[model samples]
Each structure stands twice: as structure tokens, then as C-alpha cells.
Target: MKKTAKSLLALLALMLFSLSVSASAFAFNDIQKDPGKSYIEQLQKKGLVRGDGSGMFKPKSAITAQSAVTLIVNGFGLNIDNIRFIKEPKASDYFTKVKDNAPYAKAFIIAQLNGLDIPRDIDPNGKVTREQYAHWVYQAISKKGEYAWIEMYMTFKDEDKVTKGYMDSVQKLLIGKIASLDEKNRFRPKDAITRSEAAVILAKGITFVKNTKPVPQPEQPASPLTNVRMSSEAYGTEALKVTISAEAPHAGYGIEIANVAYKDKQAIITYRVVKPDPDRMYPQVITTVAAAVYISTAYTPVLGGEVQP
Candidate 1:
């Protein structure tokens, strides 16, 4: 009985040893010398990435659109947890090519709801170019939070190859060091990104989000209408000039005459507050801003609904 028990104990020990080795084994067979090995490993550990059924990452393989969107949604921890729905959302509601039963469909739905610029008919299995991935990942980052971006344009060798709409996103990624150019100072915007390269860029974006703080926007004081006055004067015409004035906290805030409506013998002048230009500087003192619109002297001038309060 003692000898039989000893044999069973030995067998159990061997089995335990094998399980331990399996758990410690590398997740993929092809990532050993890949440039993005470390990042792939990090993502694997976080459950943000996985290898093929054959235990190969295929680092040089092109990343598909579905896979890219899934990674961005998962890597950035985006979800619809906070949003309540009367009806459960489905991928088909937002995308045409994505099937409701597809594994990555939910990710696509989340991406669309978050405003990632995905087309309605995007193919899930289609390969994405470097600029395309960059644009999507940049949109994800923006949805996460707003960060202070340096006000400078980054010139690349293939600058002209970039899509006009994606220019700002590419510039932002380059400026933040989340992505870089090749030795030739080329972004290779049109080239399809490999799995390894995508992992590296995504990992960098995740790290940036984790470590960076969002810049808070300062609140502007309300623009209150101080007065609206009318006078008659224009180039050799019997016109009535209606001046709409308001008190603004800074010179940057100004009022503009949006529309003039004639009703019941009254010239109603509608005005709207023009927000301060983001790229311009202004003095931070109380200032009176005004706008004038000339109308025929046939009707009395009155302020529109917008100028009130």
C-alpha cells in the first residue's frame, strides 16, 4: 500500500510541474525578436490582446479593421456601462457590413457611439493603413479626455499623402510622441500597418492616457446685453442704423447681427454672441462690444428673441 501511494504521489508531482511550465510559457511563438514584443506582452498580460489559435501572433500580418477597433475599445477601457438604453444596441444599427452576431460587433457599436469617424459600410475584415489606424486611435484618445496639445504643425516627408481630415490627428500623435516617423522622416500614411506596429502604437497611446492629465478649460463670463439703440445714417440712403451692444468680460467676445426680419412694420434684428477665437489672445477686462445693422427707415427697430437676457 505504501509503494502504491508513493507512485501516485510521484505522478501528481509530475503533472503539477507540467501545468506550471505551461502557464509560464510565452503567449506567442513569433514575437521573440519582434520590435513590439514588450508591448505585445504588456497587452497580453492585461487581456487586451491575444494570439491566434496556433499560438502565433503573426506580428508582420496586417491588422484588420475589426481587430483594430476592438483593440482601441478594449485597450482604452471604453464601454456603454453608463448609458442606459430602452433597447439593447446592436452593431447592425450603426454599421452595414458588421453582422450582429460577429464577435467584434459590440466593439464596433461602442466605437460608433463614441464618434470614431467609422463609415456606415466599413468592412470588418478589411486591412487598415497606418494613417487610418492613427486616426481611429487618436479619436479614441480624444474621447477619453482633452489634453493640451502644442500649437505647432509637424511636417513629415509624406505630408501630402495624408488625408485632409486626418491631418490634425496625425500631427497630434507625432507631437505627443505616441507615434513616430521612420528614419526617412516618412509616416508611410498609405501603407498597411502590421500587427506588431499597431500593438506598439496602441500601447503607447494607453500609456499616454494613463500618465497624462486633461487640461481644464477656463469658463468665460456671460455676455449680457447692456443696451440696443437706433439711429438714421448711411451712404446717401434713408436708412435706420440699429446698434446692438453688450458687456463682455474680454474684447474677444463680440456680438454679431445674425438676421433681420420685417414683421408688422417692425424690423427685428437678431443677434448672437460670437465666441472667442481659440487661437487668439484677448485682454481680460470688462469691455463693451457692439454690432450695427442698417435697415430701411420705413419700420421701427426692435431686438429679436436671442438678444434678450
Candidate 2:
């Protein structure tokens, strides 16, 4: 009986150890099984996340500052090389110790430039709080909105109170209709947001921008000389000659001619005539034309020798 009890105790101890290991393991599906699974799946499809090697998303794990930077960088396809790091990010600024050549340093810098809520006392090693995660996500999506909404909503009086403004913004991003209100019809702003929740909000914001119609630029007037009229050659089989003339009161004007089919209205044809400075006495002879067929030509005038035309 003594031997049996000892064996039982040993088995119990082994089970406890196994449980502890499992808890520490970064299982990907932990987030996958969330009620907001569909939204999470959308984010995964967009290459925003990859579950653990075991095909599980560790949803509840506290995301680190580095991890958050990686996600925001990858999600928005930001350019890291051009990023300017804070003039002096002190050693204590990061929760995890930031090495000089850390791969995500540029990403972190970019996040800060774009107004991400990077903790001033950056605990590089510390877990990212749910509040911080939500704030960052809001900033990322709110960039397009010019941050007007984020600034207003972030000024809430209480972190836990689901203000009407907060609910409105959350509803703005339906996330496959998974973002429902609590009993008070308020979104718990201070609550730690799960990975699944983050994914849904991102997807909704992306969809909103995609669906919006882009503002159309006003069309400019077409050039006056749609077609050029050339007098027949004054001599034998010598090609027909044409001269274009223009004058700028203060400076010289550049004249260009091209075939009518040219896509860029302002693109000048090198083969066509180019007059640098036209004397007021003599009109600028843009080009001497020689073609078998009388094709229509387009002319453009650029002022002050600027390349903008």
C-alpha cells in the first residue's frame, strides 16, 4: 500500500509539471478558438499573423512591444529603412533591452513617428497591456481618418466606461459583425483586447477604405492645337516644314509636338521639334516635320524651362 501511494504521488507531480509546461507554451489556437475566430482568420489570410508551429494561435499571451512593432510593420507594409529613431531612446525606455542592431528597431521608430502609444519607459521585456494594444490598433487605422476620431475617443473620462463615442467607433468597424456591445451598450475600452478582436477591427477598417470612392481630380483643359495644318512643301520631295510659335511676357516658353496617340499629354517627343528661346521678332520654329501621311499632332507649351510639363 505504501508503494502504491508513492507511485500515485509521483504521477500527480508529473501531471502538474506537464500542465505548467503547457501553460508556458505559445499555442496559436488559443486565439483561434475565440468567439471572434472568423475575424482572426481574415487577418491570418492577410498575412498579419501566423499561428504557432503546432497550428495554434496563442491568443491570450501578452504581446511584447517588439512583437507589437512587428505586427504593425507587417500589417501596413511600412518602410523601415527611412525611419528615424527617436533622437535618444534611453536604455530604460524599452521593456525589453533594445540592442543597437535589433531588426525591429526601425519598425519601432516608425510606430512612434506614426503616433503609436509606445511607452516612454519602454519595458522592452514587459508584456503589452490590452489598453496599449487597443490604442495602437486604433492609431494604425485612424491614420487615414487624420486621427480626428482617435484623439476624441482616447480622451474618455474613465477607462472602463463604454462611452457612446467608443461604441460608435467600434461599430464603425463591424469585424464580421462580431463586435457586439455589452449589457450597458458600451464597449469596454480599458479591457485587454484579444488577438481575435484586434484582427476583426483591422479587417473592418481595411474594408471601409477599400469600399470608399477615391476623390477624383478635376480634369484639365485639352491643348488648343489638336491638329497641325502644314502648307505644302515649297520645293520637291523635301518633307513638309512646320513651325510652332509661342511667347511669354516675362520669360521664354518651350514648345513640344507629338503624335495624337501619346498617353501623357505633357510628354514631349524628342523626334518632334523643341524650341528653347523664341525671339519676339521671329516665332519659335518648334520642328520641321516630314511624314508620308498627315497625322494629327498635339502641341504643349512649358514656361521658364521647368520640367513640370
Candidate 3:
């Protein structure tokens, strides 16, 4: 009886470990040695992308506009807060075949708010193209009014073959250095955005958004430099604060400290782009505004007395 009980306990532990592995990393038979394996796995871990009920992640199959938009919306963390609608919100009302409770309904609403333009007549189930996806992403970021586009001015040989209406947006993608060209310097704007390609682009967009700096401000000095706190914001406005942890109040140490941080930031941006991927055609352009984090230092008096009416 004792031996049997021990055997049962060991089997239970093995079963639990097996379940854990499946929950975290489903063994998709199709994506065993695919190039986009890492991207898909990364998204899966983030809960932004999932498999189709079964334990398969059909990596090569074409994903529809609705599904693609849903991935993009979730992957980029788009949300609605104070939106107003004249009628009851329904996907079918705005789109031709989309239903109210459909999987893509919420995504359609959120994506539209961020400048994704899927026509009412178009089928949401239709496969999304590379140019169309790039255009929508460009439109999403264009609303921010930051990040001056440094256009390469180098035209693609197959530029004319790209679909109409998406030419300008696609150009912005190249100018902003988000999408890369092939060895022949072709953007392949007319091709369908494959699952692997979509995963890579969407993942990179998350990085760009994460790299955005907040307008930083320093906490009010506690007892005049006894305690000072600062934050490095990732998104929104950019800000910086300089301080000197001097042993005595008469020290001129703040200026020396500020110069080092400023120089470090510049060196990071310059040397960071040195890694050359022959496959990547675009320059490494993070979606962020320039002229952020200007070094400024000042002394404010610490008032000990209570406020007077």
C-alpha cells in the first residue's frame, strides 16, 4: 500500500509538469523550424496572440483583416475610454458582414479610433496585404504629431506595382524606417503580409511605443536635497532633472553630472544602430520625438514654516 501511494504521487507530479509546459508553450507541429517561430512564441507568451482552439498556430496560413486587426489592436494595446456613438455599437452597422458579437467587433471599433480605415463594403475576412497593414500602422502613429520623418528619398523599383491609396502610407513606413526592403531594394508592397512578417512588425511596434519618453519632472525636494526622486517615463512627454549629492551645500557638482548623462544618451542612439542586418533595409528609427531630456538643474528653497493665509 505504501509503495502504491508513492507511485501515484510521482505520477501526479509528472502530469502536473506536463500540463505546465503545454500551457506555456504549445508544441505546434507546423512551426517547428520556421523563421517566425520566435516572434509567434513571443506574442503567445504575451497573451496577444493565441492558437485556434487546437494546439496549432497555422503560421503559413493567410490571416484575415479582422483577425490581423485584432492582433494589432491587442498587440499595440489600443483602448477606448470616452467614446460616444449615436446608436448601439455594432460591428455589422459599420462593416458589411461583421456581427455584433463577432471576435473582431471590439477590435474594429478600437482600430478605427486609431485611424485604421476598413471600408464598409469590404469583407473583414479578406486577407490583409503588406501595404495595407503598414499604412494603417503609419496612420496610427501619425496622430501623435511627433517623430519627424527622415525620408531616404530612395524609390523602390516596384513602387508602381503597389496598390492604390496605400502608396503614401507605405512611403511613410519606409521614411520612418519601420518596414525594410528586400535585397533588390523592393518594398513588396503588393504582397500579403504573412503571419511571420506580421508578428515581426507588430512586435517591433510594441518596442517603439515602449521606447517613448514621458515629460519627466522631479519630485519636490524633501528638505532641500535630503531626498530627491525622478522617473524615466517610456511614453508621452520627455523630461530630465539634474542634481548633485554634495557633502556640503557650497559644491559646484551639478553641472559635471548633467553633462555625463547627456553624453551617454547621445552615444546610445549613435552606436545602437551599428548592428547591420543585411536582410533589414530600413534604418533603425524608433518612433519617438527628438529634443527630449534637456538637462536642467536649479535650487528651490526648503520652507520649514506653515503656509500663511
Candidate 4:
């Protein structure tokens, strides 16, 4: 019986550890198979986001401008440079809603100090749309620089549908791989941003700020890869196809390409060995590269591609 008790205690400890780890990933009630789960957990781990104290993240719930600004301020580490004031600015001075003891009071001040274009009469609890959040986050990162239009092709079918004054904001984010299209190749800029999606955008936005240089950068040596092509199409939903041809051909079974992310306005593709193909030992090994299809607007089905390596 003593041995059994010891075994039970060890099992209990292991279970507790697993629960703690899972809790760290998300104490939320939802988001088990959520694509945004990793991003949300990342921000939560960094202490830039949080669930209700009772342990519910409300992942699908709409986020507010009030909370979004706070997340931007905290997640991007913008509060490091304190804004001076002739007088200690009260929340009322900047926002009509936020009181000194209000939950969003400090965030409003940080947004003000950081020069966030928050109007005094703005509704604090209004649900923030994708375009609205994009504009604000873009400003926070750029330190309110005049957004330059890169003169890139607008591929999203509904690019014109973006709310006024937010097209450049969305485009800037798209160029940086922070904001992305829906599977329908639509920006859906006017849609309310869910907490889950907000987490992903904010995390990526913050990373972009940290990595960008203040000055123009010289180009790096191009990869040995060639004929890198990207295309967008709709299956049941929209999909992005990234085709990369290698300098030389690779084995059909061994060559695999992955990590189709956006970089420098190109579909950044990564290749890795999934496993060895000992069975395909033909007379000779031929070099070839594989094309990967990331399905969905955010990521989805592959548009057909051919890689001639």
C-alpha cells in the first residue's frame, strides 16, 4: 500500500506539471485547435496580454479600442520612453471616459504619451475594427511617421473595400506580414477584430518594430534558389502558392519546402528534410525543389506550382 501511495503521488505531480504547462499556453476556456493559439499564448507568456483573473481568455469576443491601445503600449515596449507633462495629465484630459481608477486609465496615458491619435471624445468600449486596430498599431510602431505608400499591386479582391484612411495602414502591415487577407482574399477591414486575431497581429507587429532598422539596409545575397514564384487562388477558400526552384535538382522524395511566410513582399519559403527516403534509391539522385501551398487567406490551399531546379 505504501508503494502504491508513492506511485500515486508521483503521478499527481506529473499531472500537475502538465496542467501548469497547458495553463501557461492558455488558461482560456476555448482555443483548443485554434490557429491563433500559439500567438495568443506567446503574448500571454510575455505578459503583454491576459485573460480575466478567473482564467477565461474570451478568445472569440470582440476586442475594444481601449484594450487594443493598452496591448500595443505594453506589447511593443513603448512605455520605456516616458512622455513629459507640464502637469501630471489626468485621464480626463485625454479621454472622456477613462477615470483615474479605471482599468484603462494608464493605457490611455501611455497612448497619449506615445502620440496615439486617440480623441478625447472617443468611445473607450467601442469594438475596434481590423482597419482601426491596424492604423493604431501601425502608428504606434512607426512613432506616427507619415505612412509611405510603396506602390505595390493590391491583390486582395476587396482591397477597395478597406475603410477610408486605413488602406495604407493595412498595406504596410501586409508588407510586413503582420496583417493578412482572409481565405477569400479579402482584407475585411471593417470586421470586428476578435481577441484571438488581435493577439497574432499585435505579436507580429511588435516583432516587426523590433527587427526593422531606422536606416535603409543594403540588400543581402540572394539564396541559391531561383524562379521563386507566388500566386493566389481560391479552392473552397483562398490559398497562397509559393514555388521555389533550386540552383540544382533534388530528389523527388527528399526535397520538401515549408515555412511559407511573407518577407520583403515575397512569399518567404523555408525548406527542411521531413525524413529520409531510403526506398527511392533510384539509379541516380536527381536534384529538384518542391512547391508548398499554404491554404487560407491567413494561410490555406496551394495554388498549383512547378519548381524546375
Candidate 5:
């Protein structure tokens, strides 16, 4: 009897373990099989969605208005903190109903500005439908120049038959690369867009836009004045030393170089503004180099330089 009881207890433990394993497997599959997996994964990899405590993403679940705002913000690279909220919706305002303190307000504003915001009412507690998702995805693709004029007209108008005028416009814009007609040369516009279809369209749209964009030329090297260091040489003459520095790519940079003399100081030096380079590439090494020089100048002093209180 003792051995049998011990065996039963072991069997129960094994069953519990098996159940736990099965639950984990389900959770993992849930993320992979979600309809929004592509966007969710993209957002997750970009550090956007750190999913709630639940292991599952709950993809079929309704997205809150606030959550939608956050997704739009992170997905499209909008400034969330600095966006101003006005009581009335103006041409300049992004959202008509969103309050100043609303979460994801910046993203909502950007979406509105870019014409990507859905025309539907803002229902904070409502569930997003598959059709709505398609519309939003279509908006995103259109922003990237994926859909030709004809395709856009068809998609936006939800027409059963595309007119010749629309087709001609599409042909002009897309140059025959887009706007496919059926065997009867009829453009089917009323078809319901599927999730997989949307994914394929987005993939193609991003690729096409990127390939068609002009490649920017590398910027010219900075001159010797890129980095300037000043030191006190004498009571009347201050030596300004300059160094040229190159920076790596994708670095945040701001430059400010000024020479300020104290009110009672003997130095007559004044801050001279240098012409900013016209072809400055943002987030580049040159920007950092310029910023470093500016910072050094602010703290360094000439022989007669007076310290500010």
C-alpha cells in the first residue's frame, strides 16, 4: 500500500509537469500564430511592445485606444513627449478629441498629420476589426508610395469598377509597374483584404519605396575649425586652438560654440558665430566632434576670462 501511494504521488507530479509544459507550448504558439505577429514582432524587436505579464500576446484581443496610440508612435517614430494638445482641432492639430495628457498623443497627432489616421470615431474601449486593420495597413503602405494612383483610388473608394480616368492616373504615376487588371481588364476593388495579403503588400511597398529613393552622397569632410580649444596665452592675447574631428554614424549631436567674457574682466573677446555647414549629415561623427568642441569652449577660459556667478 505504501509503494502504491508513492507511485500514485509520482504519477500526479508528472501529470502536473506535463500540463505546465503544454501550457507553455500553447503560450509560445499564441505569439507565433497571431494575425498581428508581423507587426508585433517588428514592434517587439524595436523595443516597443514588452507584453503585459501574461505570456501570451492575446492577438485576437481588442486593442485599447491608448495602446493603439503607443503602437502608432513607436511604429512610425513620432515624438510623444513634446506634442502640444489644443482644445480645438486645427489644421495643425493631430487629434481633434485627444487631451494633452493622453498617452500616445504624439503618435495620434503624427498619424493624423500624415493622413494615416483612420476616419472612424475614436473609441478607446473598442476592438479593432480585421477590415480596420487592413485600412490602417493600406494607409501605411500608401505613405511609403507603394500603391499607385489607380490602386489607391480603388482601395480608398471601395469601388466595384475602376474608371479609365483613375487607371490613366495610376499608369502615369506607377509607369505600368502597378495596377493589374483581371482577364477582362477589370480592376477588382471591392475585394476584402486579408491579413496575409496586407503583409505581402506592406513588404512590397517598403521595398519598392526604398529602392526608388535617391541615394544620398557622402558628406564632405569638415575643416580645421570643426573642433576649437582656447587657452589663456597672455593678458591681452588668447590662443584659440582648433582640431578637426570625424564622428561615427547615428550619434545624437548638438553644437554651440561661444566666447563670453565677464563684465569686470580685462578680456575683450566676444563670441563669433561660424557659418554652419550646409551639407551636414545628421547623427554623424562630425556632429559629435562639433558638439565636443562647443562644450570645451564653454568651460575653458582665457587669461582675463571672468567666471560667471
Candidate 6:
């Protein structure tokens, strides 16, 4: 009996191991020869995308607007987690065509809230053009954080065909090497972007954001404020608590640590004042407010970043 039980246990373990490997290594049968096969596979393996029901990825098919939005939103991990909604937001609130109960409706909402340039009356089922895809991908990358890019313009044979609003995104992608023009040196801006092409662009954008760091922006004139102060103290043994305090005209005005950049053994902190809600009322009285953050002991805290009005 013991010998029989051991054999059954070994068989079950082997089956589980095989299942795990198969799940991770899953690939679409039709994408083997596609130029973006590897990129598609990368996304599929990470659960950011999937093949059609029959194990085939129609690489040549034009991707719809909703699908494009869903992929970019998931691939870049965009979310509205930090946003406090007064009521449950729905797709109907922001878009005219997206159905509230549709599978991709939530993604559209997240994309819009994250600052993607989605039109209010966009047709979710309509095909997404290459220029549109490029713009959204670029905007999604921006939401991750600001990264330095070379200042240059890329000229293409069909530059005139590119929409004015999308020109900057195309140039930035080309400059970053996240995207490239065809052998004929033309970007078919109006062409409906294929699934394979979309996959490749998304994969490149994801990689770019993963390996890049936010660069500090050029200095700007500090906003005039009253009684601003900053200080740092030891937090436990390995961390430092950095704090910033400022006087506000009323309780409704507040301050927050907007960003932190670590460079040259210095933890540069940027802060912004939070504006009070327009619809809410607060006492009209002088107030002192503060915001704090903990950083590693290895770096010294320094006040940085332009204060926003």
C-alpha cells in the first residue's frame, strides 16, 4: 500500500510541474513567422495579452480601439488607485460609445484618467490607426514618470500625413528607438495598426519604462509662499524622516511630497501644495501644515523640484 501511494504522489507532482511550465511557455501557433512574434509571446507569457480562442494570434488583423487601450493600460500597469472618486465612475460618464458592462470598459476609464488623449465620443469598436496607437503608448509611458529623451526631430516621407497632435509622440518614439519607420522611410500614420505592430510597440514601450529613470527637470522660479521650512531626522537606524512644513492661508490649503529622486548620494525631494476642493468649504484662518517621507540613510535629503502653484 505504501509503495502504491508513493507512485501516485510522484505522478501528481509531475503533472503539476508540467502544467506550470506549459502555462508560462504558451505560444500562438500562427505567430511563429510574424516579425513581432517574440514581442507578442513576451506579452502573452506575462498575461498582458492573449491569443484568440483557437490558439492563434491573428497578427495581421487590425486591432480595435478598445483592445488597444486595454493592452497599453495593462502592459504599463496604469491605475486610478491614488484617485479618490466621489462616486463610482463608469465608462458612460467619460465616453459616448463604450458600454458600461463591457469587458474593456474599465480599461478605457483608467486610460482616460491616467491622461491618455482619448476622445470623449470615440468609437471603441473602430480600428485604431498607427498614429493613434503611438500617441496613447507615449502618454502611457509619461504617466509612469518623466524620463529624459534626446531633443531631436525625425523626418519621414509622410510627415505631412501625421496629425499635428501625434507628431510629437512619433518623434519621441523614434528618438528613443522604441519605434522606427519602414524601409521606405515612411510612417503610415493613417493605416490601421495591426495586432503584431501594436504588440511590438507596446513591448518596446514597456521595456523603455522598466529600464529608464526619471531625470530632474530644469529649475523653475519657486512659487511665492509663506513660512516654508524643511528638516530631516533619523528614522529608526537605517532611514531618515524628511519633513516640509509651510503656512497656508486656510485649512483647505495643503502640501504633499510629489516626487523623490535619488542621485549622487542625495535624496532630492519635490513637493507641491494641494488645492482645496472648490465645492467644499473650509475655515478662513491661518494654518500650518507639513508633509513627510522616509528615505534610506545612505543618501542625504535635499529639497528639490519646482513648487507648483
Which candidate leads in lDDT? 6
lDDT for residue 167 in candidate 2, whole number 0-100: 48
List runs of model 1 lying over 4 Å from the truth. Answer: 1-16, 24-26, 217-309
What lDDT score goes with residue 304 in model 5? 17
Residue-level lDDT of model 1, residues 229-308, one tens digit each, is 33334534677667777678788878888888774345667788877899999888888888888887665565654542
Model 6 per-residue lDDT tens digits across residues 240-299: 888888888888888899888774345668789888888999888889989999999877
Candidate 2: regions farther than 4 A off:
1-32, 80-97, 145-180, 183-186, 213-309
lDDT, residue 36, candidate 1 = 88
Candidate no. 1 TM-score:
0.66
Candidate 2 residues 11-92, lDDT tens each?
9999999998875563344664576577666777677777767867766655566767668656765543432221334222
RMSD (Å) per prediction = 14.1, 18.4, 17.8, 20.9, 15.3, 13.8
lDDT of 5 by residue, 1-309 (tens): 999999999999999999998657434245675544675555455565645556656555556555654554444454323322212223223334556566556566566545555443465444443334434544544554443333333332333353433433333323433223345654344443333333333333344455564345465554323333333322324343322233323343322334443321122233222344567644434433442121122223322111121
Whichever of 2 and 4 has more lDDT, that candidate is: 4
Candidate 5 total steric clashes: 2
Name the weakest run of 10 consecutive residues (lDDT summed) in model 3.
264-273
Question: Candidates sorted by lDDT, descending order?
Answer: 6, 1, 4, 3, 2, 5
Clashes of each: 0, 18, 4, 12, 2, 0
Scored by Cα lDDT, where does model 2 land?
Answer: 0.49
True-structure lDDT of candidate 3: 0.59
Q: What is candidate 3's lDDT per residue for 121-155, written digit by digit as tens?
A: 65777888888888777666654435555555658
Name the better of 1 and 3 by TM-score.
1
Decoy 3 TM-score against native = 0.60
Residue 276, model 4, lDDT? 41
Stretches of candidate 6 off by over 4 Å are 1-25, 217-307
